[model samples]
Target: MSCSGCSNAVNRVLQKKEGVTSVDIDLEKQSVLVKTDDAVSYDDVLATIAKTGKKVNGGQVIA
Candidate 1:
């Protein structure tokens, strides 16, 4: 994200998701690290991120 507001908006949207546990945003890297449970899926996370009105470059699942 570009600024704290942007990150906060994203964080808020992500945190509202069912299984989201934590959200870490690195503005310099323009990346967000989200921790979630099995109740959340990769696509679901992507969709939720999209709801923040940000362009998602890409995303992956980390074991």
Candidate 2:
């Protein structure tokens, strides 16, 4: 993400997903930290980010 707008876009999109509990975008790191329940899948989260039209350079699950 480039700016607050970019982060907001990610936040808005991810928050609408089925099991996304929260979304935190770190513009500096160009990363999105998404919190979800067990019901959510990585593909679902990726698809949601894809909907925002932002290119994901990289990503990983914390646990």
Candidate 3:
């Protein structure tokens, strides 16, 4: 996630998912601040990250 390219790519993928109100991708922080609904499950996030060869976890969601 330190790489800007990877961060942007992952950000783009997350942006496409429904229920995701908004997202703040920070390469420096190595985190993605996502404002989403309950429908946005960890699996949904992981799948989105997977599209960019990255991975997502429950704890990473910020809730």
Candidate 4:
């Protein structure tokens, strides 16, 4: 994201999800780091971000 507003918007959207415990946005890298639990599905996260009207380059679950 280019600005704080973009980051905030992403933060808000992801925070509302069921298993998203935290969200960290790196504006310089234009990346979002989401911490989620087992109950959350990757598809759900992708769909949630999609609602923000932002193009997702790609994502993968870590650990």
Name the best candidate (by lDDT).
1
**What is the C-alpha local distance difference test score of candidate 4?**
0.89
Q: After superposition, how far is residue 41 of candidate 2 from its true place, in Å?
A: 0.7
Question: What would the per-residue lDDT of candidate 3 be over residues 1-63, giving only the tens digit for each residue?
Answer: 768888889889888999988988877768787788998887777777888998664455453
TM-score of each: 0.93, 0.88, 0.78, 0.92
Query: What residue pairs clash in candidate 4, if any at all?
Result: none
lDDT tens digits, residue span 10-50, model 2: 89888888889988777887878899999888888888899
Give every collision pair in model 1: none
lDDT of each: 0.93, 0.85, 0.80, 0.89
Model 4 clash count equals 0
Q: Pick by TM-score: which candidate is best?
A: 1
lDDT per residue for candidate 1 within 1-63, as digits (tens), equals 799999999999998898999999999999999999988999999999899899999888998
lDDT assessment of candidate 1? 0.93
Q: 1-63 in candidate 4: lDDT tens per residue? A: 789988888888999998999998999999998989999988899899988888789999997
User: Looking at model 1, how many pairs of residues clash?
Assistant: 0
RMSD of each candidate? 0.7, 1.1, 2.1, 0.8
- Global lDDT of model 3: 0.80
